[model samples]
Target: MDEGWDTVEVPARGSDFLQLAVADVPAGGKAEWLAGRLRQAIADGRLAVGSRLPPTRVLAAELRVSRGVVTEAYRRLAEDGQVAGRRRGGTVVVAVPFTTTPPPVPDGGSGEGGVPGTGGPGGRGAQGGNEAGGAGSVRDAGSMGAAGSADVAGGLGWPGDPGDLTGPSPRERVGGPGGPYVGQGAGGPGRPYAGRRVDRPAVPRAGQGTPRPPGPYPGQGAAEDGQPYAGEGGGPGGLFGGEPGVEVFDALRAAPAAVDFTPGRPDLTTFPRAAWLRAERTVLAELSAGQLGYGDPRGAPRLRRAVADWLARVRGVRVEPDAVLIVAGTAQALTLLHPVLRADGVDAVAVEEPGSLGARQHLRNGGLATPPVPVDEEGVRVDALRATGARAVLLTPAHQFPTGVVTSGERRRELLEWARDGGLILEDDYDAEHRYDRPPVPALRALLADRVCYLGSVSKLLAPALRIGWLVAPARYRAALVDAKRFNDLGNAVLPQLVLARLMESGELERHLRLVRGRHRRRRDAMIAALAGHLPGARVHGAAAGLHLTVTYASEVPDTEFAAAALAHGVKCQPLSWHRQSPGPPGLVLGYAATPPGVIAEGVALLGRALRELT
Candidate 1:
């Protein structure tokens, strides 16, 4: 009898979730009956290892039985080493017991009265005579209800009773007209035995019977076109053919070389990772929900204010926070400026002759013609710039690209006068913070604020991955630039802007600048020194400032051919002619900021050897 039978009632729900069940057991054997079911489930693969058996209370509720019934059943399985109760992680099936084999019978009936083998004709007579003399002994071993009868039956050819085997054993018995225990006739869902349990049918699931729609047959109906597709190379349905074009930096990025000395890269290893992480944590903790949402197209208010303060402190440019337009580096600034300039009847802008090829391409792509203006030791010559009859001239007055010359005071005054006469000046204050031998020069924007559109970025100061820069234009074009930014990705990402603002306000950016400037100065010196020793005839220009030095060779060798030969010798550099729209003497623009001093020496030495071989 099970304990607590009066205290609990069996649950009406069937087993589904955990596959637990209980039923009324036969008289005198309910505990053992339930234990055998669990053991059989474990022996076969139905109940996997580490599977958690339900708690006694839960299993009792699901099976409509007393909790003690489930507990006693689990205890019997535990006693057989088939299951173990784990605290909290629950009761788990552990191992199963193997069935034992019966002992072999002695030859020639040695354990019984002596008799001839049963295969002979007198065997039955001999067996009956021994049984008659030993009736009690035969009854003790051979009777079904006697002790040791199961051991003897195991040796005989009789299969064990299905009830004594496992639940649902290897066969099933279905009810016939006789009774619930009667076996059905012939073949059906049940097996050919009586008094055996049947397996529970698998429950039908909700979505299992639904069929999926078939896919389209192959080579049918124009290949199931989703949209009107177009082939490559500019058709009416092509991606770019239906709209205005966009440019990509594909060619320059694809070229391979041993040493790349292309300009516009900073020392990435000097990025202030610790300071950035600190800023990020602070921003995340303090930022408001509205701040993380789409920000003002102009920029975040904090970063704009910080940028305005920074420009006033470093570049000597005064501005309201509203005047600063945060952009995706200077590239976006140029793109935005392009339309405004074009609408102002500015068909052509004058560029320095040996200037940035990328900048020239950017302007040309925006439907503006680029007229070449000569750059001398004093930067872009205002006299020559005026001769081009162009209303706009782009100048790098702080540190000219390639040549690295500062625009002199006389030329600044001359250029300011030219701008005052209604000529627009695009001032690229690039690499102005980096100078070894001279004091800082005032930006051209400060001298003539109304006429100059100033551009600056952290690409040189920190890393290009930041992609954060700013532009301050005259009031005339401010609204147009903001609209362009609004349409282009709905302004820059807000989180990086917040982190950058924290860095700027905390004075960490200035500390990083001081460290890199010292390293770059040493590298620039190594290149200059190596050039002096190896190529005595080469005239080095722009050695006082910037990340690179320009060396002009007096020898009669083509600049492009010289660059190719240098690349063959495992050194990469750009020919000055690549940046020039007008003819000039042969030279190479070599960057040294990212390379170490030793590598700089080796690269310059290779260049010298390549020059010798080419000349």
Candidate 2:
């Protein structure tokens, strides 16, 4: 009788969706118990950004409570701006409680960590902090979705009027008299808030606030998917070898420079906000129920179709929509292609010696080898590529990455012949739309669609925060790439795709392109003129078209150190060494589109001063 088990399990309650502990609540506090549990879940990170909660009815059924109780709880959280209910998308988390560890106590201040009675930051007492009138941080949050209107005060559905922070707390308002269950009156089956009357602060109407114009999301920059631009600390020597992807942006953002010439940036301030908002409203109004769910990994069908048409009309690349596979951006395209390329008997990819360091890193990280090939004025040296014996190669053909050289007619022919010889070409058509001096060139994919895996994105055209791109692969590799995309995050978010499709179909995107091209051209001319006036000895390259100017110095100085010095002088630009795999002359890649004309001139002047001190 003594050799028995020691553990006993309690019988499970309602549905699996309702995560609750009945024993934790007192005898008559079901509504309070549920509301407290939801707040705790949000604070403890059990529910994160973009997470959806169960419907009010379903949750009420699970907890075995009247539907009014669940509705009341959700209304309280909505007032706090922690969650918002989308029409069909359900209730989604919009913001989280801002908690931080208390900083080291300053001298002459109270020795106590936090408030007198409450524990320090993140303590149990502060854990139940209210949204309004609490001694805690309260920062603005980004937009939730199409269901929630813009709230200039803070997050969607948050309490208080614009610029007013002294409003009563949402929880306090709910717990006050005549609230959810405070003065419980037998109001039949519904009407949770229709209990006995008492004086209380009025609740702000849903989505009520002064609306600010829509634009890119907060805390993001041009040419980056939320990562900072390359900084003084990030070059060829910094962590991750200054990979040209988002990491470089992270480093650049960390620098305290006032003037930035970080290349590959379009005029982000000129983003078509009015047009985008119009398109978003149209898409949301027409969105079917199925559109809100998981999407095709190859991207939304509408976007793929729109992309094919846009490329054909604008870039001289004609292809059917079926051949297009939508991706997050060029970075994600490379990621999905790596495994496919490796499995196709290709172990190494040849890159231009002074090629994109980030592209090389992506390939290498995917377990493939990257061999350096040389690049000259004609473009990537075809003869050098043959010497490397690599089966695949990555090239920025429309406009070369740093040098911005257009692939010559002869060079293009030779490369197509090479592709015909069983070699694969990954053509990165980056920033080819902003050309100033010449007519647009036909994409290599347009000429030899079967031989080239073409990649293009809206990063340079609009904002990188959109994270939308397209990939066109040879027929043989298309299926594998599609499968790879399928298993990677279940595809990009659908609403943006649908909205972008609407913009493209409506000709707003084309209008935006025409608008930015003129702005970018003016900025380019300003930078070129500034370079001539400021640094006469510095030779500028790639000025014909593209967003940046490359200046090569004949001195044998390390570009990394030169760039770091320039950063110290309150200017930030990428060193040429960061993009190269082989030894090259000391040079700096200066982006022009981001800065205004005056700032461009000033940034170049700082570069000139930095150069003088280096010598």
Q: Which ten residues in a row have the lowest lDDT in candidate 2?
A: 212-221
Candidate 1 global lDDT: 0.58
Clash number for every model? 3, 8
Q: With candidate 1 superimposed using the best TM-score fit, by how many Å does residue 602's alpha carbon deviate from the native?
A: 1.3
The TM-score that candidate 2 achieves is 0.61
- Per-residue lDDT tens digits for candidate 1, residues 1-615, read 111112222232223212222223345565676676667555533343554566677555555557788799999888878789888655777875564642222111111221111111222222111111111011111122211111121210112221111111121211212212111112332222221222222322432311111111010112233322111232111321111112212322334556666666766766889999999999999998888789899988889887776665455454667888999888888888887887787866778766876787677667665666666545677876776667888877766777665666556667867887888988887686665544345565644566888898888888888889998888778888899889887888999999999887665675576567667666666676677667765655555457776666556675666766776677766666556554455678788887776777788788878888876
TM-scores of all predicted structures: 0.59, 0.61
Candidate 1 residues lying further than 4 Å off, grouped into runs, are 1-252
Q: How does candidate 2 score on lDDT?
A: 0.61
